[model samples]
Target chain A: MSEIACVECGAEIRLDEDVIQNEILPCPDCGVELEVMSLDPVQLALAPEVEEDWGE
Target chain B: MTRVAMVITRVRAEEKMLLEVFRQRGTDPELIRDEELVINPSVIDPRWDEFDIVLQRSLSTSRGLYLLELFDAWGVPTVNSLRTASICSDKFKTSLALAKAGVPQPEVRIAFTPQSALEAVTELGYPAVLKPMIGSWGRLLAKVSDADAAEAVLEHRQTLGNYPYHVHFVQSYVEKPRGRDIRAFVVAGETICAIYRSSSHWVTNTARGASVEQCPVTAELQDLCRRASEAVGGGVLAMDVFETEGGFVLNEINHTMEFRNSIEPTGVDIAGRIVDYALALAAQLERGEGE
Candidate 1:
C-alpha cells in the first residue's frame, strides 16, 4: 500500500498500513472529501489502530 | 447524456422539481423507492455507463446507508455521497463530526438503553430534548422539562421492548425561537437560500405541520450555515440551525433534504441549483477519473 487515488477527487494520496487499517487519509491536493471504507479489510493487513471512545 | 436516478420516498413537490430539472437538462432520470433496495456488495450492477450520477433524496438514515452501499459497490457517483450522508444521518455521528471539524453543534448524547437514558438525563440535566437517532418529521420528539417527565419518557421507551431502532438522541434543548428553526440550503460552497420554519408545536419541522417563514439571511447566519456545510464535507446540504443566547447552535445537518416550499420565496431555484452543483461534482469525478 504505497499510494492510492481518491475516488471522488482522484488526488494521489500516499497510504501507510497504519492509516489504511485505521481507514483515514486526506487528499493532499483536492483538500475536499475523504475515501473511507464502505467495508473493511480490503487488502487484509493487521487491523487499523482503533479509537476507543464510545459512550453516550 | 447521463441518467440520474433519484432515491426518494415518493414523488412529491421537491422530487417533481428535480425531475423537471433533469428533463430540462436533457438527462434521463429515474425515481426509485428506497425501500426496494437490498444491500449486497457482490452484485455491483447499476448500468453505471447509462447513469452518470445518483441523487439521494430525503430518506431515513438506515435506508440511506443501504442505498449508499449499493451505489458504492456499483461504482456510481452520488450526490451528498454515502460517507457524508451516513455521518450526517445519525444525530450523534453528525454532532461528533461537526465537533471534530471545529464546527459549533449543540452537545448530544446517545442512549441505547432506558436505564442509560435515565442516567444520561441525570448527568445532562433537565429541559433536554429526546428524539430517535434516525428520525424524520420530528416524530417521537419530547422535551423533558423535568426529572419526572424524563423518567416517564424513559419508562415508555422501556415498555417499547428491545427495539434496535429505539436508539435515543438526547440533546440540550436550546430555548430556540418558540417552535422556530432556521434552515439554510447550501450548494457547493455557497449558501443558496435560507428560511425560518415555525410550528405551533415544539418540534418545528415542515412535515410536522410547521409553516415556512422568510428568515433574512444575515451575513452572520450565512457564514454559520456555510461553515457548517463545509465542515460536514460539502455538497448540497440543508442545515437546521438554532439561535441560542450564546449565539447559534447547529440542530441538524441534512444531506438529502426537502426545500421546495422555502426556496420559491428566496427566489432561488433550489432544485435546479442542487442539480447543477451535483452535475459539477459528477464532472469533477469524471475529470478525476480521466486523470
Candidate 2:
C-alpha cells in the first residue's frame, strides 16, 4: 500500500496497489470524496460532483 | 481470446467489479475512458477495431448513446445496440416503444410549453409526475400533488433553460405497496435477477438512499421483463416496475444499468452475467452469425 495525504484535510490515505484511475475514495478524516486522477505518481483530486446528466 | 472494451466516464464500483470479473474469466478487458476518447470520423482508428465487442457503460447517457451509434457505424458490436440506447435514453421515446409493443406502463403525456405541460399534468390528474425527457437516478422527478405544485415545478423547469426541462414528460404516479418498487435485471433476453428498492420517499431509486432486498422473479415479472427488453432492443437492461391494484407496470428501462447494490441481495453475479453475455456476443460475431 502507498500512503498519500488527503487533499482536503492532509490526513494520510493509504491506497492499494490495484487502484485504478478515476476510482473514488472517501477521506477517512474529513469525509470528502477523492478521485484517483493518476496512479503512476499517485495523484489525487476532489471527485466531481454529481451532474444532472450523470446517471445510469 | 475475445478482445472486449468497456467504455466509461469514471471507474465506479460497477465498472471495477466488471473489470475484475473479466479478468477472472481470463480476459483482460480494455478500459476506454470516454472523456479522453477522441474519434476521427474521417480516419478509422485501428485501436477501435482491436476490440471484438464493446460494452457501453458510460455514466452519461448522451455519451453512451453517441458512442454506441459510432460503434454501430464502425461495424463494431456493442452489448446494448444503438437502437436500445437511443430508445432508453429518452423517456418519451421509451414510452412510445413500450406503448407500441403493448407493454404495460404508466400513463404519460408530453407537451412542449409550460402552459401545455400543466394541461398535460392536469389531464394525467393531480399527483402526476414531471420528469426530464432524459435523466436517471430519479433526479429532477417531481410528484406534483396539486395545481399549485404543478405550476411551481413547471415554472421552475421552464426557467432551468435546458430544452429537455422545457419539454415536459408527465406520468400518472402509481401508488406502490409498502412504498417499494421492483428493479429487474435482464441480460441477453433473460431475467437474471431482481430487487425491491423500498423507501419512504416517492422516488425509490437505490441511488436516492432506498434500501434493497431480493425480489423473487415470478412468471409474470419474467414475462413483463422479456417483453420490455424486446421492446427497447434487448441486451443488458434494468427495468423499473410499479405495483398497483391492477398489476405491475414498467416505469422505465435503463440501457446502462448500475448493479453494485444488487449483487448480495439477489445472490446473483450480475457483473459476471454481463461479462458472459458480452463474451458470447463476441463469439457470435466472430463466427459471422451476429448483426
Candidate 3:
C-alpha cells in the first residue's frame, strides 16, 4: 500500500495498493477532499470543487 | 440476461441511475471507463463481442463519438448509433437533417469567414445568435444584439485562430416567453415526456440552474418529437424546443443527453426506457437485423 502525507492536517493517508490517478480521498484529520493528481511519486491536491449542476 | 457494456468517463448521477436500473433488472452490465479505452487495431479484443450491446455515456462529446464509432465498427449495437451521434454532434449537420425532414427549427447559417458570418447575421436581422458548430451545455453561445456585438464576437473567433472557430455558426434567435424553453426526452422512437425548463435568464438549459416542470405530452408534441428523432437517424435523443408565439420550433437534438431533472417532472422511467431500448437493439442484433 502507498502512503500519502495529507496536505490538510498532515495525517498519513495510505492509498489503496492499486490506487489509480484521479481517485478521490478525504483527509483523516481535517477531512479535506484530496484528488490524486499524479501517480508516479503519488501527489495529492485539493479536489476541485464540483458545482451543483441541474440536468443538462 | 442482456449483457451490456457502458462506456463512461465519470460516474455522474445519470450513470448511477442507469446502473441501478440495470442491476435491478438482473443485467450483469460492465462499466468501461472511457479514459482507459483505446482502438487497438493490431490485436482487437474479442471480449467486446461478448456483450449483446454497448451504451455510450461519456460526458465529453468527442470521446463519446469516437467510442461509439469504434463500437459500431466492432459490430456491437450501441444505444445511440454512431450515425446519430456524429450528426447531432455537429450543429450544422443537425440543422440540415432537421430542415430536410421538415422539422421547424431556428434559422441557422454557416459561414467560413467572419465577414460572411456578419453578413449572414445582418440578413437574419438584429439580435441574431452565434454558436459554436460543435458543443453542448450552451457554451460559446453569443447573443449578437447588433452589428457591433456581432463584429466583436466575430473578431474574437478570429483571434482564437482555430480552424473550427473560423466556421461561424450563426443562428436566428426565437422569441419565447421570458426564461422558458421545452426539453422533451425521446427514447427508441417514443416521445417519453416533455419538461418546461424555466429560468430568469435567456438560456434555459438545466445545467444553467433552469427549473424543470412537466409539460403535457400533446399529440402535436409527440408527432414533432418522433419526426425530430427520425430526422436525426433515430435513437435515444433529447430535443430542445422553443415555444414561440408562432409555434414550437425545434432547437437542437442531443444524442447522449442528461435527464436527471426530467425523471420527477415526467414521471416516466427514463433510464428504464433506455435500457429496454438497448435490449431490444441487442435482440435485433442477435437476430441479425443489422449486421
Winner by DockQ:
2
Tell me the lDDT of model 3 at B155.
Answer: 97
DockQ of each: 0.01, 0.83, 0.13
Q: Please, what are the lDDT tens digits per residue for candidate 1 over residues B1-291?
A: 666787764444567778778889888577666646554567665454356788887345666677777777677888877777877777787888788777777778888877788778777887888876766666567899888998788778667735744677788877666768888887875877788888777788876668887778788887887777767777788888898888778888877787868876688889889888777777777778520
lDDT of 3 by residue, B191-260 (tens): 8888999988778888778998999988888888999899888989999989877788899999888888
> Where is model 2 more than 4 Å wrong at Cα?
none
* Pick by lDDT: 2 or 3, better one: 2
C-alpha local distance difference test of each model: 0.71, 0.91, 0.83
In model 2 chain B, the worst 10-residue window by lDDT is B37-46
Interface RMSD of 1: 14.5
lDDT of 3 by residue, A1-56 (tens): 98889988889999877465555677878989887778898998886664212112
Model 1 chain B weakest 10-residue run by lDDT = B40-49
Total backbone clashes of candidate 2, pairs 3 or more residues apart or in separate chains: 0
Each prediction's TM-score versus the true structure: 0.77, 0.97, 0.85
**Model 2 vs. true fold: TM:** 0.97
**Which RMSD does model 3 reach against the true structure?**
5.0
* iRMSD of all candidate structures: 14.5, 0.9, 6.3
Model 2, span B159-254: residue lDDT tens: 875887889999998999999999999997689999999999989999899999999999999999999998999999999999888888999999
Best by lDDT: 2
